[model samples]
Target: MSKTVGAEGWTVVHQARQKHYDDRYYGQFLGTRKDGRWIVGRMWSGRSMDDGFHDGGWDWSKRFAEPSSTDAADAALKSYVEMSHETFVWNRVFEQRVGEAIDAYWAGPEVPGAPRLSAGWCRTPDGLPGGSTVGLPFHEAKYRLLQYLRSTESTARADLSPRTFNLHDAVELIRQANGPFRFQHGYNAYWLADDAS
Candidate 1:
C-alpha cells in the first residue's frame, strides 16, 4: 500500500482505485463487500486498480495502523540512495589509489644497486631490459619490477616461455620478493619491444 502526508501529518488518502489507511488496504466505494464492513484490499502502486484479497478475503475487524511519517520515509529513502552512490564513489577511489601506486613505483628513481640493463633491454627510460628471450631469473627484484609494469599493461608480452616464466610463475616470484611495492597476482606477460630507452 502507499502512504502520503499533507502539511499537517499522516492521513489516509483515498485514490481512485482504493483507499490507503496508513499502509493498510481499504476498499473503494465501488466493488466493496455487501456488508458495511470496510475490507482492506491490495492495489498496485501508482495504478488505480485493486489487486484483490491479500491471500484470504479482506478483513475489517483489525484496527488501521499508521504508516511511517512522511519525513521518516523521505529520510530513509534518501539515506539508502546516498549509501548506494557512496559505494560506487569508494570503489572508484580504490581503483585510483591502486593506479597511483603503480604509477609512482614506475616513475620513482631507480633502486640503488638494482639490476641495471642497457637501454636496449627495456624501451622505458628506466633502463630496464625488454626482450622476448630474456629469461629473467625467478628472482625478487625482477618480480617487483614486473608487477609495476603489469599494473599499467595487463597483457604486456614477455619472451619467457611457459616453462621458464608463465603468469603464475611470475606472480609467485613476485610474492617471494615480498617487497613494499610488490603485488600478489599481477605479472601477465613480458614487454616485447626494442630497448629504445
Candidate 2:
C-alpha cells in the first residue's frame, strides 16, 4: 500500500533514495496540477567534504524541466536525471526552493518554489552526444570518433567489406563501450579508422 502525499497543486510523483551522506537527495519529481510540466532534480550537498566541492555554503544543485507529460512519465521511471546545473550558489536559496517544491508536492493548494537555474553544462565525455546532434557536421563527427577511441579500449577498424553501418551497429558498439556516442557517415569510416590508428 503506497501512501499518497501532496501539497499546493503539485504532487510528488517519485522520490529516490539517499544512497550516501554527501548526497542531499536523489531523483525528485514534482508535477503541477493543471500543467503537464514537471520539475526534476538532484542535489549533491557534499556535506562529508569528500570531494572538496563546497561553494560558500552550498554544493552542486541540479534541476531540469520537462514540458510534456510523456517526458514527465518517462523521467519518473528513471533512477536519476541525466543533465545537471554545474554552478553553485553562496546561500541556500536554491535549496529552499527545492524544499518548498517538496513541501507543495507532498502537502496541496499553493504554488511550489521555482529556482532560477541557468543553462546547464554537459558533463559527459568529449566524443559522446551531450543531447542531440542531429545537424552535427561530418568533420566534428570524425573528431568525436577519434576522441572516443582514445578514451576507451575500443579501437576503430577499417571495414573493406563494403557494408553500411546502421543504427544497430552503433548501438551495439556503444553498449560494449558502456557509454553514449555519435556516428560518422559511411563514406568517412575508412578515413576515421586511419585517423584513429
lDDT string, candidate 2, 1-197, tens digits: 11223233344443333334345432233333335445443334433333222231122232234654434433532313332222222133444343333323322232233211111112232343322223223333333443333222122232532354432344234223222233432322312222222
Q: Report the CA-based lDDT of candidate 1 relative to the real structure.
A: 0.31
**What is the lDDT of every predicted structure here?**
0.31, 0.32
The lDDT of model 2 is: 0.32
What ranges in model 2 sit over 4 Å off? 1-8, 21-27, 43-68, 71-80, 83-197
Clash pairs for candidate 2: 6-106, 6-107, 7-106, 7-107, 7-108, 8-108, 8-109, 8-110
Q: How many backbone clashes does candidate 1 have?
A: 7
Model 2 residue 72 distance off true place after TM-score fit, in angstroms:
5.1
- Per-candidate Cα RMSD to the true structure, in Å, reads 23.8, 18.5
- What would the TM-scores of all predictions be? 0.24, 0.24
